[model samples]
Target: MAVNEIRLSRLLRTSKMDDSENTTSFDDRSEAYSEVSARDCLAEGIIGLLLPTVEQIDERVKSTRISQLELRQHIDTLAEDLRALSEKQQIPYDLDSYVKKLVNAKRRVVLVNSILQNTQERLNRINQSITRENERRTALLEPQVSTPSEGQ
Candidate 1:
């Protein structure tokens, strides 16, 4: 038998012996008294042994609950940090898009400026050609008039 069972049997035997010695009659009352005392002692012993284990279990449960709560708080903080980091990661992409738009606009402006320069150069060439043609016509007309006056 286990130690607790041996101790409980011993306690029952001692209570029966004490009751038989104190009472003259080995009646039902004496048997009842011994049984009650044995039961009481057994209950007290069981409670005594179980109390510390119960207390230790309660302490462990409390610590486990505290640890679980701390882990949840850490997870919440990490989630917030992850959200902030995600937002920060998008900044480079937004900046890249903005820069691309600016570059496209600059390219359009440069293309327009090149077309305007070509058109201005063509207009200047046409103006010079027309001025030369007008001067040549004036010189030919003046020489023809002088030759007619000298022949007469």
Candidate 2:
């Protein structure tokens, strides 16, 4: 399990929520991933990063390229995690995991950048929600509500 996790984490490829563990192509995940809700993608990205590795991330990202077998292993692990999440029924945990995976994912453009943009847009949306929420709250608390009974 650990070895598989490490392999998947290293490859950094587009992950699927379906039966694609045996698949060697990113095109399947990319085609369906965009249609996936933001939360699911973010959650998947997080799991991708949390999985461990023996090689230092820097070297994995830059110096040496991963083999097809390794990439397949990575994809397999991710698919497992997605399957687990589906089974466990845990929703978006946090950004830490997502961000961590994204860093590796970015390093994995040849490896795993397809869903990066989609994941990023999700983060942006979450951030925008916070900003908009703050704005809305500030507007509400501005002490500008006039009492209808004041004149009465």
Candidate 3:
């Protein structure tokens, strides 16, 4: 049948032959058979023990693949979220430039207001000086008119 079975059968047949023709004793032949049987049992036991380990390794590989897939999904989700946030933060105009322009406009307004205030102050001073001169001239003319009329 199988190669090992054929070999074992051949060995058994040879062992059963007349002892005078074969120098091997009966005890020696029996001992050899027992040794071969022990080796086969040991080989079978090792294979049986290793089968579960192979299965466990296969299961672990599958689990790792699943975890990797989930991690990839999470990474993709995070990437999408980051992209959305980027889009939301993106503005059509430059905010810093706009703020700078506003600041410049405010400075210009302040400067113009200061100039207007200075001009108004100068005009008020001129008006006050003219009023004082008019008052002095009236005072001088009133005394002259009174003296002239009394003499007439």
Candidate 4:
């Protein structure tokens, strides 16, 4: 009977140790899961912030492109008017100043279009970078997402 009690005590102690180990393992996994959840939340927040800004930038780029087109049309119209005035009318006292003004406007349009093109290119690069980052986030998240489902 004493031997049997000793064996039972050893079995109880072993079972308790197993339970303790399981609890520790569960705690460690739960902490890791919490950390991963926090990382996912942060990534989602960053995506939310970045997407809207990228869309706004795209809208601005389109608006600027339209403005460039309008400016080109204006330049063409001014050139035509100047050509007709020179061809059919006597040179007026203010003609030189008027030509100078048109030239200045053309120069300003060219400068603005150049700036807009550069800005559009930069925005494109930024959008690409954001897309790449989103893809990377998805890649990081996919395996974590799949493992539990696969186990189930």
lDDT to native, each model: 0.53, 0.46, 0.55, 0.70
**Candidate 4 C-alpha lDDT tens digits along 76-123:** 798778767877786554466777777788788778878878887888
Cα lDDT over the full model 2: 0.46
In model 1, how many backbone clashes occur? 0
How many clashes (backbone N, Cα, C below 3 Å) per candidate? 0, 4, 0, 0
Best by lDDT: 4
lDDT tens digits, residue span 78-102, model 3: 5556556655785644344544554
* Top TM-score prediction, candidate number: 4
TM-score pick, better of 1 and 4: 4
TM-score of each: 0.42, 0.25, 0.42, 0.70
User: Is 2 or 3 the stronger prediction by lDDT?
Assistant: 3
The residue ranges of model 3 lying beyond 4 angstroms of the native Cα positions read 1-15, 90-152
The model with the greater lDDT, 1 or 4, is 4
Q: Write the per-residue lDDT of candidate 1 for residues 70-132, one digit (tens) a residue.
A: 655564565556556657894544444444554565556456555645654554555455456
Off by over 4 Å in 2: 1-111, 144-152
lDDT of 4: 0.70
| Residue 20 displacement (Å), model 1 | 18
Off by over 4 Å in 4: 1-28, 148-152
Q: How far is candidate 2 from the true structure (C-alpha RMSD, Å)?
A: 30.7
Residue 118, candidate 4: Cα error in Å is: 1.7
